[model samples]
Target: MKSPLVVLTGLVICCISIPILTSVVSYSNIKQETQTKKNTSSQSSKLEKNEIIKKVINYETVNKETPIINVYNHKLGKVQSMNMEKYLYGVLAGEMSAKFDIEALKAQAVAARTYVSYKQGHKNPSQHKNAVVCTDFKHCQEYKSYEELEKVNGSKWIKNSYSKIKQAVDATKGQIITYNNEPILPLYFSTSSGKTENSEEVFSIKYPYLKSVDSPYDKISPKYTSALKISNKQFVEYLNKSYGDIKLTENNLKNQVKITQLSKGGAVETMKVGNKEIKGTDVRRIFNLNSANFEIDFENSGIDFIVKGYGHGVGMSQWGAEGMAQEGYKYYEILSHYYSQTEIKDTY
Candidate 1:
């Protein structure tokens, strides 16, 4: 019925149409795949940028003006008020300045801030008699007043006797206490008689009427002594002789140490002596005095004296700070002396 030429033309048209349709479908699929890959790449790039931004911003910037809560206990009921700066200073108290990493410090600051903020204005009227028993370290018994401390120990005056504790508390305003930021109670004593076994035993035998019992870890203690022991007169003389040209005054004697100006080392707290900078830990090797000797039995004169703690024997002994605060020293003076230049600014 159909012509041979018509059939041939129809077959040609079919063949042409099939190839064009196939090409269109294939091109469309390829374009779709390309778009998908581009989208995925763009998303990945965005994610990388976000991560970089996060890394760049510090905690202070990210969580600006967040409320700080100082929790008195783990119970979450008793709390005090503080800001991030105050809390961080409290947490980083006594630690060398260089040891602080900003991010890590911020995290700690947040936790302390929360704890203190939660405890604000909590008046439970609980007996101050709840003593902190030191399981890891020995603590002294709590005394109501200086008279009570004297009655128990035979030493009447704790004012000048424990002057370092008072000075540190006065200097820092009680915000920066705690060795390593662990909460500890403060114990007051007339002397350091009950601090060590040897000291306690000797005091007990020497003074039979005195009570040589361990006291709570108060900010005040008998362990307070100078880093380099020269008599007050000798110390002044050393300052006058070493730095006679520079204006010397009793008020500036403590602040006159040029070595304190240097920033804390990355891993080591150091001081500059002459041309050589020395680690605070190593200063004992260069100087020696009978009074400067600590933690060493001088019975053997040849042996090197081993020191117990670091820093000058003034203010909140870092270990003593936590102890005193746990026993309860309001957080103001803690920040004062430890950091000479800084003030406790409210961030919240």
Candidate 2:
């Protein structure tokens, strides 16, 4: 038989050993779980880092080069190929004044570039004949080479101005305005009569981004207001020349002419002269008025045309851009303001 003291000592030892064994197993389980969590977190971090690296590689892999464009020199009647960026320098010189703010010039550059891209995509083979665009202001955007610019502005102006124009072009290189992943028409004009017109109202084609918008800063344009007085006989003769034979007399001008419709932008849409209905655009063309927007007042011996603004008044206003730039708006911001629901995208 065993001693009672010995038995009691054994029982005490068992009690202490049981707790130690339980603690060891519990600690082992906790360590394993902690290791598993650490491994998962490390794997997630590595995957995130790998994704970042892949994106960096993809961005670095793309190579961009300046595009070459074929321009038809309408005066010379020759197609000339040159760098697109160089073309923009000439376009900026011809379209917008060099004295404009850098931001405004940049905005014009992007618009001109987008215009070229859009035209290139929808090439009127008959109009340009293998040329991407023409130098004619009536047909395509205006473009003036360094030689032409020097002749027009003098060598002194070129020395002081060309650098700024080049800077504007280079700063926004390979950028174009896009709506719905396509280049927009990018129409622009000298000024507006406080607002822009919808594309449908002016061009008979509707575009969502080309909706009417307010442009109150165009008053700064020198062509904002103009007046021309034409004698009753001259007015009647001009109308007759354009619109076949119409029953109209010099003295009865006030009673015979009637404005039939006005555009939402407040420009004349149609007018009736005697028995003939003439489009406001046709009238402006026949009379050489500054724009389609005009008001006719009958005078004792003549008719006076009071004109406001210039150009088609259907898109970005040049003077309005200058005003926005002067107000500290960035080029992109100016574009976004003028072209609704559009995005600036890099062209590669």
Candidate 3:
């Protein structure tokens, strides 16, 4: 009925209105769905986080009273009696937290127990003997009695040795450590090979027997050399084998060996053996080749050797500890001297 222009305008208005209404409804629905999803996701995530925290918080409390039993070797009998605390103390004592696992702790407990029992009465199980009450090796120099040794060495030597033995017995709980389950006795070596002119030649009495050698430092045998020589390429191979797979290059050689990460309360380090990247704990086990008590042949060296020191190089060097103790260092001070980034806590 209206003019052609008016009819066209009315049609255009209707078309635009329909589309605008549809778009507004679709957007409202989409916004509601998105908000619902976000709320659900946030709640789920919060629940997961709370569960993880709860588990962590309950771990110590749950395991605190767990009964720890003594693990024994059938050959040696009951090695040692311990609960968690005592076992933990033993691992810490050896600076072995990096390699510490339940199995390792059990092994250490056995060793500690066996050592303690052997020290207590294994020397002469049938007979009870009084503890060795002397000051130093010098005092035990074929002297008839403590009085005689004291007279010869003087009051200082007597006091030092007595104090040393007391401290040693107390620290080890009167346990006699066996190199390979045999009693570790004082081993003596002549600083100068083939009987010396000096009556009191420099003697090393503790573990990892350090002997004075006449050979030039460079000419020193590879066994005695501490520097591990490996080319850049070889180091890469070593790392792959020892640590599975890792990012390594000639550039990493600058750091050499270093603790890269810690896992399950253990230290993980990047170490190069030959020319490879190996990741694991560093345990230094030292062996002595110069003890006269145990004979060795340079040509065909085959001896049932008994050695000491649990992990790499030399540890708290017992002789070194004794020296520090003599100089009035306490037990804690002696422990701190050898280990870094460690705190002393009561085992009990």
Candidate 4:
């Protein structure tokens, strides 16, 4: 027979062991959570640090090797090859106004360089036969030759503007924005309605770095506010085509033409024109409007459109960048503000 004392002692030991085991498990879980949080924080810190480095990178130290870039000139009817820097001179002169701040010009240079790099990496045979990219924005970019530049900016303003553009291109020689060590599509537009849109929202393709960010300077752009007027009959006719047969009277357009949906960035995602629905881009295309972010109003004689900004409202806004630079922000600052989760790196 076992002693009562011995049995009681054994039970006490079991009780103690149970609590100890529970405490050990709880401690292990706590430790694991702490480690996970630490790892996440460390990762975030690295990303921020990388961005800071990019913001401060010396433009003069960038690689100066003048690479040969093949350009398909639409006017020339043949592939023309020239120094990459020379190509930039024309692109910068065409893309943005030279009257902008120097920092803004530099930002444009980086954007143009990154855009070219992305195109180079994803070379499409269908795009060009003997050229890397073309002189048209539809094919590649808007390349303004010296003569075209003189024509657009005029003989008087061309000299000063051209020099500023050249300075920007020379300063940021071979820099490109990269994400995960790969060239990224540095899409820039004319203006925005205060904020940019995520790539998925505008294009249906989710790009990590192309997420929406607020651009306070966008509203300051000269083209920020524009009005377009059209007859109600024209508006309804376009809607009928989009709807594939919808009966919409002129009265319906005045009473019911409204925005049905909006993207997170405040751009019109879908709008109701009478009984039919259409995308914002469709409205812009049909009427040759300034931007997708617009409001429709019914006037007694015609339909009036109050547009907030210009372009597709995705990626960088050139005027927005210029405004930012004018407000004392640097070139890298403008780039970082527009493109989220991206780093500017030297192409060398």
Candidate 5:
């Protein structure tokens, strides 16, 4: 009874309905897959961030434990494994006067510890291949064992000084001077010439933290001003020793050997020794002057060098630290004053 047109319309409806149902199923599957991918990507990102945070925490805690170090004892000619704190005690004794204020000793301890830490982190120095540091003051920091201290300073000194030194070391257990969250090269000397020398002025490399700063307290140092008298023949010979052809004379020495330039820190930068130019540092080593900040006074018989300060005139001044401590400054304050733009952090 049905017509042929009605039958064709029914077939068309059936085909269209089948395709619509299949499309709906496909859309549902695609939506589920996309959601799953989004969830996975979010988890992966969180994991990546967590891993980065973990790495930073690990680096910060790397030196959380005390480290035993190998020291090349110049006298024994052998490597000695010693506790880090004990080593610091020896360094404090040798590098600084035990009679210094407690705060000054603490500052020296931190400086010494930071210096050794910096050295150990870098490649082993060529001078001491098997050791992290050496006892030779010329190469590394000076060190003296308890026995050596007893021999040099007497038993009474060892008894009184040892406890004081230990208190300083223990009070500041693992503290070190750092710049940019890294250990710094804590170069200290006996005294300064009114102000510390900028790193570039004294050495080839310039450090941001090692800038010239006034050290008014350095005058309190015993070695603040010293005069060395050298005969004319001796002075001329000393100049010629390094330069080979310096034409300096005993008479009119000031005219011939003139200080051509002075550093910002007030040290001689360059001096004209007759026709030859020489560095102030070379002059210091040649004449064994206390520091490069010296004036040459020509006399009838000899030359007088009126020198100010001692050592290299760079970084922390030992006597200056004591002076600051005497002025009621804390160890950290003393350190901050000398090492500009630096922080004290616990390395262990």
Candidate 6:
């Protein structure tokens, strides 16, 4: 979790045959740029209509014991423990936007809570001791404090967005998805590639609740399409940077990139970069592309990668959940649609 300060390191790359770096700025001052501040609109939205009635929630009071989560701040190298419900406010704020449907937010709240619940004992090796999770995108869920939300979300939507996230967390207090009375890890991502992939395909682990399923609604996601173009020179540079043995000449550049395999969800499973076979995940990381579900186009000027969907195609799709919520699906129904054979359990 980066504190309230946002930083950026900038290099002005000149558009020439050979790469030219004109200006370099300090990483700490990168956030001081005008455009960087403009990127802070937290797109956090509508609660779906529900037939289930609201009841007295909060397992803390019901069980006569408050549940607390030890969160390790990766940047600060400190541990902070708070009531589980309070932690979710930051999770929901950090994970999903405020503009999402209220039901979708609630669904995210449940999934995030369940994920932490299942990962309580299996802690990340952060600097702090007894830390259940770290505020890192790769290790654990992203977390944004209320104060951070205020700065990033701005003054206009800050109050309302916080209110919506808080309501979702409060409404689903102490509720988690379980299978056979055991808490299940409810993994979720930004969006899917028209369908969600099975757990085995992505992580090579089998979970009964994680299965491939049609998520046609994901097609309507805002991030459904992304296009990036790499010049011939730039493409060669990136390839040589990663795989020093890459030998793609100007004539063979068009045919150098090949799709070796495809995942069940139609995402690139493995791709051949010249002589090296690399995972699509690696390619996505190398280019900072939105997702692995992409297609490459060779043109006279450069090569273009048109990506579909976003994030890892596994578990629940956030935008898919929002689409379902917009179509009048309840929170639990949306959860069941994504998590397969799972039960919604109330610990209280």
Best by lDDT: 2
List ranges where model 1 is wrong by over 4 Å: 1-6, 29-87, 93-104, 116-347
- What's the residue-level lDDT of 283 in candidate 1? 39
List, residue by residue over 5-42, the lDDT tens digit for candidate 2: 99999999999999999999999999999999999999
- lDDT by residue (tens digit), candidate 3, 237-293: 654554564565554445544434322212222334334543432212112233211
lDDT of 3 at 327: 51
User: What TM-score would every model get versus the actual structure?
Assistant: 0.22, 0.80, 0.26, 0.80, 0.80, 0.77
Candidate 6, position 57, lDDT: 32
The CA lDDT of each predicted structure is: 0.34, 0.89, 0.35, 0.84, 0.88, 0.80
The better candidate by TM-score, 3 or 6, is: 6
Which residue pairs of candidate 2 clash?
none
lDDT for each residue of candidate 4 in 1-348, tens digit (9 for 90 to 100): 999999999999999999999999999999999999999999999999898667664745555577898888987889998898889898888788888899999999999988888988888888787778888877567889988878766878766778889999988888888889898899889998888888887888998888888888877788898998888787777767767676688765656777889887788889776666778888888888888888877876678889888888888999889889888778887888888878788765
- Lowest-scoring 10 consecutive residues by lDDT in candidate 2? 54-63
Clashes of each: 52, 0, 18, 0, 0, 11
TM-score (C-alpha) between model 1 and the true structure: 0.22
What candidate 3 gets wrong by more than 4 Å, as runs, is 57-227, 230-348
The runs of at least 3 residues in candidate 4 whose Cα sits more than 4 Å from the true structure, single-residue gaps closed, are: 1-56, 59-64, 151-158, 241-244, 254-256
Tell me the lDDT of candidate 1. Answer: 0.34
Q: 1-348, model 1: which lDDT tens digit per residue?
A: 899999999999999999999999999999999999999999999998897666442112132344443323222233444443433343333121212223223222332333233233233335222211101112211112233334653553344333333333223222322322332112121222112111222121321112222323522433434233343344345435543454544443333333332111111134443334544334343344212124322121122334333332222233344443454343333323222233333332
The deviation in Å at residue 295 for candidate 4 is 1.1
lDDT of 3 at 73: 24
